[model samples]
Target: MSGTSPSVAAGAGQLPGTGRTAVVTGASSGIGAATARRLAAEGFDVVVGARRLNRLEALAASIGGRALPLDVTEPASVAAFTAALDRVDVLVNNAGGAFDAAPVAEADLDSWARTYEVNVLGTVRLTKALLPKLRASGAGDVLFVGSTAGLVSYEGGASYTAAKHGVHTLAETLRLELCGEPVRVIETAPGMVRTEEFSLNRTGSQERADAVYRGVREPLVAEDVADCIAWALTRPHHVNVDLLVVRPRAQAAQHKVHRDPPDRTAAR
Candidate 1:
């Protein structure tokens, strides 16, 4: 909002600031990890947040950044995280998950609630907690890693989709509300990103996880979305991408994929 900002294609990177500080939630892995690295390489002080202490710490150590324990679902955790941080230039809320295989009729409310808790409330909790620091930093930027599910609903993603929709709405509202101020709110919706733990974590089973992406060609990699994020966050002061949708070339929309034909002779 105030101090520094990026390039025409963001290939050149963001503005130079020795004190460029950023707080990235869900920074333990995937897009978060990639972004943290990108920012660190750019000379910014980075703070990585996540529930997995070992992973978070390792990531933080690897990037030479600070690590903070944060669970978006927990207020105390979020509060502690933000309270300790100062001079926040960028906020990357990349903490959301999708449950892969539960049918709507057999949906478990408990799991569904957990999904909402971490996906929607988690982002809200962390964002609100850090607003003061973000605002004070002058160049306050809040970026949410929403999903294409928010834009398009699909099978077996009831709760996840709902939470993402909430994220979309939140980003929109915050953009309008914070427009008068220095703060900038933006959201990126990724289609199907093949991250390390996404499938296993989402399905709650390793075997089932493998089946989710069975035979889908060239799924979107975490770096793909991470690169988009790096590019998006580095935009100039007056230029806000606002909303970006990124997905695999093979996938046109949520729940739709271009699969290869079966090997009839080799298969059972």
Candidate 2:
């Protein structure tokens, strides 16, 4: 907001990252990574955050964005991310994931707590820490990558569901709370996506992750979701499309899907 970017720096304040500053968390892979690339391509100087420095470095180098090794679960790391950025125009809080899939009867407290720590608390911590910069910048946009899981429940996904629900609540409250500010808050909730890294990161098993989507057809991809985010961000300054839920044509809800079997006989 308050920077000498030579672009919005002359007008009625520039967007946080417009030719200057943007901060994207959970940017190692998937939506976060895509958003960072999209923002950089949009001419924002993007800062990427994640626990994996190597991945972060590679992504940042490839896109010409800066990388900050951030573990959102830690207060110190969040503070550091905030300290590292000069002024942020867009804050994409996309650093979250699905954790554990055991039934309530067999759930462990550790996995449950970790889910909140990353999804809910991680977002809250980073958002609060960067509010000043967002407010300082005249036109800042904050996009949270929520899920349909936050809206609907799936079997054996109680922890992830509840945590996602918390995120949904957070986004709604922020939208109302920041009503008069120049900042815009948007929640992009998508149904099942074909991001291979999402499943692998959630389960820590590539084989298992592939098996989960082995037969699924027409799942949403990372760029598809990124396209939606880019569209929301480039909208008129007076418009705020607060909550957007996107799913593949085959997906009706979290529990609904249509799959076309691969052609085995066609190979013959």
Instruction: Name the 10 consecutive residues with the lowest summed lDDT in model 1.
Output: 1-10
Instruction: Please give the lDDT score at residue 85 for candidate 1.
Output: 80
lDDT of each: 0.80, 0.82
Whole-model lDDT, model 2: 0.82
Over 1-268, each residue of candidate 2 has an lDDT whose tens digit, in order, gives 1112233332345542355477888888888888888777666788999999999999999999899999989999988878878888888889888767789999988989999999999999999999899888888788898999899988888999999999999999999999999899999998888785878767778897876665566578887888787677766656787889999888877777766565732333
Cα deviation at 41, candidate 2, in Å, is 1.5
Top-lDDT structure, candidate number: 2
Tens-digit lDDT track of model 1 for 30-112: 88888888778666688999989899888888989999898889888887887788678889999888764577898888888
As a whole number from 0 to 100, the lDDT of residue 261 in candidate 2 is 64
